[model samples]
Every structure is written in C-alpha cells, then in structure tokens.
Target: MRNILLLICFALMSSFIQGQEILGDWYGSLQIQGTKLPLVFHIKKQDSSYSTTMDSPKQMAIGLPVAITTVENSQLLLEAPAMGIKYTGEYDHTQEIIAGTFQQGGLKLALNLSRDNFTTAINRPQEPKEPFPYHAEEVRFYNESDDISLAGTLTTPEGLEKFPVVILISGSGPQNRNEEIMGHKPFLLISDFLTRHGIAVLRYDDRGVGKSEGEYATATSKDLSRDTEAAITYLKSRKDLKISKLGLIGHSEGGIIAPMIASKSKDVDFIVLLAGAVLRGKDLLLLQKKLIEEKSGIHDSIVNRSQEVFHGAYELIASNTKTNDALKEDLAAYFKEETNNSINAAQTNSLIESMTSPWMQYFINYDPTTALKEVDIPILALFGKKDVQVPAIENALALEKLENKNIEIFQMENLNHLFQESETGMPNEYSEIEQTMSPKVLNLMLEWILERD
Candidate 1:
C-alpha cells in the first residue's frame, strides 16, 4: 500500500520540470488502473536557473518541492532525490507539450505534460458542509517520545459536557488530519458522523505530514504507535472531554497500530478495525499485489511471475540476517537477473532503498496477530467484501482464529477498502463514488461503539 502511494505521487511529480518555454503551470494526468490523477507543475525562472513545484490536485497535495531542475537542449529534467524519483522529457515546442517518462523503483510510465491548464474536481457529496452541527476545534498535542507536536481536529457533539471519544488513525502514507485522498476526506466525514451521533472524535496528521513535526521517512510503525499513545495521553489530560470511554478507530495500517497500543496500554477501552490486516506484512502484501493486479485485468501469467519475484524478495528481507549493504547488493543482483538487465542500476538502487527503509523493514516482518491475541477489550473488525487490498475472507478468517469472545467481525458486501459501495472495488473508484462511507457500515460501527459502554 505504501509502495502504491509512492508510485502514484512520484508519477505525479514526474510532470514537473523547469524549462525556458515551460514557465507557469503545466498540467498532466497519469492514468493508473482506469483512474486519471491530474497533476500540475508550477515552474518559474530564478535568474539563470529554474525553480519548480508540483501539485497533485486529485490527491490534494500542493507546492511539493522539486529538488533538482534543469533544462538543456530542449531536454527537461526534474529530480526529487528525497523521493527517489526522476523525470526526463523532451519539450516539443511546436506541439507545446513535453513527452516524458517517469521512473521510480525500476518501474517506468509515460507521462506527457501539456500547457492546457486542466483543472479537476471530484464531487464528494458526503463530505460535511460548513456550519457543521458539532463543535470543532483545531488542536495540537505533543508526542513526548519523538519530541514532535502533532496537529489534529477535535469534534464533539454540541451541548455535550462529556462524551465518549475515539481517535482516528489513518492508513499508510503521509496522511493529513482529514485523511484526504483523491479529494475525499474520509476522516473528516467519519469524525462528523460520529460527533453528530454524540461521540467525540480526534483525528491527527501523521508524523511530518501536514502541520505535524517529525521525520516520516525514518519513522517505523512502532514510532507511529508512540504517536498514537501520545494522542491518548493528551486526551486524558483534557478536562472538557470524558476519557472513561476513550478508544481507537484505525483504518488499514492504523488498524494494526491500534492493537499494538491496546496490547500494552490499559488506557484503550475498545477498538474498531477497518480493513485491517490480520496476516503478516509480507503475506498481506503478496496477496494484495496479486488481487489488485488481477482485478486490474492483468494477465495471470504476468501476475504470477511478478508475485514469484516479489515472494523471493520478501523472503530474503524476512530472514533479517543480511547487512544493509549486503542485502542491497543481493537484491539488486536478483532484480537484475529476474528482469534480464532491463532495469538500470539507478532504478535498482532506488528499489532497494525503498524496500529496505526502516518502516518497510519493520512492516514486512511484523505480525499483527501477536498484538491482536493479547487485546482482551471489545473489538469490532469490519471488512469490505470487495477490498482487494486486504481481501475480506483471508483477513476475517485470520481474525476469527483468535477465538476471542469479545471480538466481532463483519464482512460488508459490495464495499471497497475505503468502505464505499463499489462495483469493482478498485482504489481508483474510491474518489469517483459519490458516497464517502457506506451508511450501513457507519451505522454498524456507531452501534458497536455505543454498545461497548
């Protein structure tokens, strides 16, 4: 899931370039699995050099820095070393377009830039309107462990002196407080609905994302768990809210982190898992890749071959016996041999770096069952039948094996990972769907939480 976001955001940034003729804003769209992600590049000339920034309108990311920009002989180049992405495009002056290829982690995609000033807006009907019926406050809390302040929103039902509260933990990626993706703010919608129903909700930005402070690139899931613990502690200190019924509601990666906290802390009263993974990270990712690709209509043979390659890679990483440099060299050789040298050295290095990051290393080997088995509090695990990312049957069955009488698992039919009633249940359809969250699922969650005390 993290890799998917990295690819999408990197491809969007690929359209950004600094060229003499490419000043102002250049727009482009990267087509991924039937979804068109609209990207905009703001380019300006600074003395003899060029400066550029990227905007992913669909993803609601703006002013993303392009670390290196150069134009020579009509060839435009943009590089963001921090993200391990590079783009090279040839400016066609006659057509007023830049023909380019975006490359990251040995994957390459065609991304042509145009000066057409294309603007896109997704109509999210379920997104709460202003003048909300709840009391919303912008709040900040410090993560004492990481020495960083996290920014978030706290929403409470109007006229409620004290109320049950749940902290919203987002899925993977560097999400803001709203958990905005493809122009849909899931956390905001969830918070609004819960607050309206007399439940207080707190949703914060992930470390180093949005208004929060910390280094997201280097932080592992354990570090994120500490951040969540900080939120719980911060809430306990609030006199305006009741902490007696405080709990956690996490989506995907956040779902896993909730258990990690609950297993160790007595502060967590309950937990709701939304499309959480019950399998080990490597197993979950392999299945996720296969299912998502198969749903995207990729040939079985291709999907099988890709899975085989990744399986081998994952196995090597799981061993955890190799040093960083040694593992990088081994993986590079493996990828080179598997791809028949079609991938270049730079691409291989990029892939190695991403696969071996602190977070990825931890996630690939971590098993959520270790924490889930220890959680004795009431648990509500929900899954969308169409969620290819964490297939309903495999994960739900795994959760059931825990045999904890306090846990209840439900598989919502016709819904996707994001809980929207979906057709194909692909991530691409999340933004296109009119609903932010299925009312049935939301109601079920509210009922479960309310029933818990």
Candidate 2:
C-alpha cells in the first residue's frame, strides 16, 4: 500500500516551467494491483487567482494550493509550502501524462499522475467497538541524515520518562511509521496500545516511506538495518529514554531485521518476534506465494508454473556459478515474454519490481534460521496458529531448533496472520473482520521488556 500522506504531500513539488495557462484537469495513479485508479489533479489559473484541486477515486479529499517553486514547459517543480513535500513533475503534453518521480532526499522514486474525473468515498476501517485500552500520541522527529531529514513518531505514556523504549522496525514494503494499509494503520494503533501500557515506542516512516527520505522499493534489508541502527542510536542519546534496557521488535520481514540489529548492537537488551520467519527468505516466499494462491483460489496448474519460475529466479540469485552475457539475455527475454501480456502495467511492474528489486534479491538469498543462532539476547518469538502469510508451524519448528537457551515461544491459538483471533483458519479471515494484537500477547511483550529493566 502506498502511504497517502507521502504521496499527496510531495505531489506539489514540481519543477515544470508550465505554459501561460497550464491549468487543466490532471489525474494520476500509484500502481497497486493491476489497475490505475484515478488520482485526479486539477490545476486552475483564473485572473490573478492561481490554485489546484486534487482528488482521487480511492478517497475523499480537497486539494490545497501549491507554491510553484519553478515551472518550465515540460518540467515543473512545485512545493506545498504547507506540507513541505516537494515534487518535480514532468509533463508529456502529447500523452497528457504527468509522471516521473517525487523526490525528497537524494532518491528520485517513481510517481505517475494524470487527469480525469475523480470519485470519492471514505473507507476507514471500523474502530474497535470494544473499549480501547490505550491512549497515544504521534509526534514527528527530525532525524539527521546525509541527503534528507528522516521523520518519525515517538509514542510514550501520557507523561513520563525513563520508560523502556522499544523501536518498532517494519517488515518488507515502503511502510510509514503507522504501517498503514486500506485505511488501517497497524503500527500506529500498536504503538498507541503499547504506550498506554507504560512502554515507550519509537516508530518511524521507513526511509523513503512517509516523510523519511530515500527510495522505498530499491532499499535493501541491510539499508533498513542501518536505518534501525540510527533509530537505536538516537534513542540511546536521549535523556528521557532508559537506553540501558532497550528492546527491538519486528514483524513479518521485520522479524528478520530484529535479529540483524541485535547481532550487531549491544545496546538492545531484548527482542520480540511476532509471526517472525526463522527460515530462508527464498523458501519463505515460495510458501507465501503458494498460500496466497490457495487463498485467492488460484488454479493448481498455474500455481505450479509460478512456483517453478520463482524457484528458478531464487536459484539464479543464490547461485555462485558465473554466467555469460548470453544467459543473461536469455533470462531477460524469458522475463519479458512472461509479462508482455499483463493487462495492467503497474501490476506487471509490481511483480517484476518485487522480484528484481535489490532488497528482494538480497532477501531471497539469505536464510534467517542462520541469524537466529547468532542472536544472543533474551528472545521471545510468537506466531499465530492460523497465520498463512508466515506459517506458524514452520516458524515454531525453526524456533525449536534454535540453540539459544534464552528463547521463549508462545503459540497463539486460533490467531490469524496479524495475531488477531480467527478459528476458521481460512485465508479470508484476515479481511472479514477488524482485529488487533491480543491483549495477552501485548502484555507478555511488555513484561519481558520491563522486567529486564
């Protein structure tokens, strides 16, 4: 899911030297699935009044006027003096496409927008009908980085210091500090709950995610490790945070990153894993693809073929054998042939990008099981019994194989991928209802971190 705050905030920064009257109904899209949903951008110029209206098919929003930093015929640099996100929009007058990238730091990432009629509807996920147990805050911080200012939110108790601060690292994807999706921000809610319980939380927009500077898709896991390292270092320097008893928590792909951080940093006092994978990423992806196919009702024949292709791709990334240019050309040709007929270019790009990206490449080559042994901290690994995204059975077995004596395992019964309760165990269970991290699981984690302090 594209973090909307980042997209809309940066859309205003374009370096296009627009024509005398470059105002019109503009539209664009952030390729999610295979479809180009409407991202309607309307630029108007009337007398001395210069303004723009932005809309999208996905949600209801009113566009705010942008401060035109610079406008040249084909290229435009626009800035939203209000939000501070700047974009350099390249206009193709003939095709009526304003696309290229939205830049913040040194990274220029892809962004595509156009012009069309926009529809609006609010899809906010249902809030908990049951009383919520936590109070929270979302305060942005300015992280000092080389190319851009990294931004993050610090969630803590209503008013207190010397709390056991935990840095929440995101799993794979360009995730904001909230780890938002389809109207629900899981990490934000998670932070809210944890903080109300007396734990301090530090969660940030993954570099290039929300307000953070960098390219999300191109970032490798190692790069994320550095980002997390920066976060940990930042916490240690703070007078309010009790850095001596710090903890690191990761989920999904984050599960892998937690160990990577703990292996290098002596500052981290404990670690927690929720639905963490303890196997090779290549192997994990295959299982995930198969499970997704099964849940989505994909045909077995097609699933088999996809598995073969993915297996071959994974092997290529991991192989030590040298290859000639001809082989490379052949592989490239095969990839093109396979995707040439996709109906949605963005979905096709998503598949190709997911497979070909640096992080994915690095991820597919390494095994997390190896890292678990080296992670010599007080470790707690938990998995939902019904999780399909990362099978609880596989992860539990891997944890069992861990040589460390300090490891703890909690097998949550009837829980779905997100640790929400679901007995059906069907793949559709995750989306059918709203669920949050169980209070039991949350309490266990807090106790683990606080006890050590």
Best by TM-score: 1
The residue ranges of model 1 lying beyond 4 angstroms of the native Cα positions read 4-25, 31-37, 42-67, 72-75, 79-119
Off by over 4 Å in 2: 1-148, 158-161, 320-328, 333-351, 423-432
Q: What tens-digit string does per-residue lDDT give for candidate 1 at 263-340?
A: 989999999999989999999989888887787778999889989998999898999687888988889889989989
Task: Go through the candidates in order and give each one's C-alpha lDDT.
Answer: 0.83, 0.65
Q: CA shift at 369, candidate 1, in angstroms?
A: 0.2
Query: What are the per-residue Cα lDDT tens digits for candidate 2 across 1-453?
Result: 111111222234223345744677765565534434345567666566556655442332324234555756677666553333456778777776777665543334566666543322423343333343533445444444534456787766655545677888876666778765434466766676677777878888887766788776567777777788888777766775554468889987788889887987788888888888887878887877777666656799988988887677667666625443443444455566665643233333334433555676677777887778887889899888878777888878988977688788988898866677776554434343356456677778877777877
TM-score of each: 0.87, 0.67
Clashing pairs in 1: none
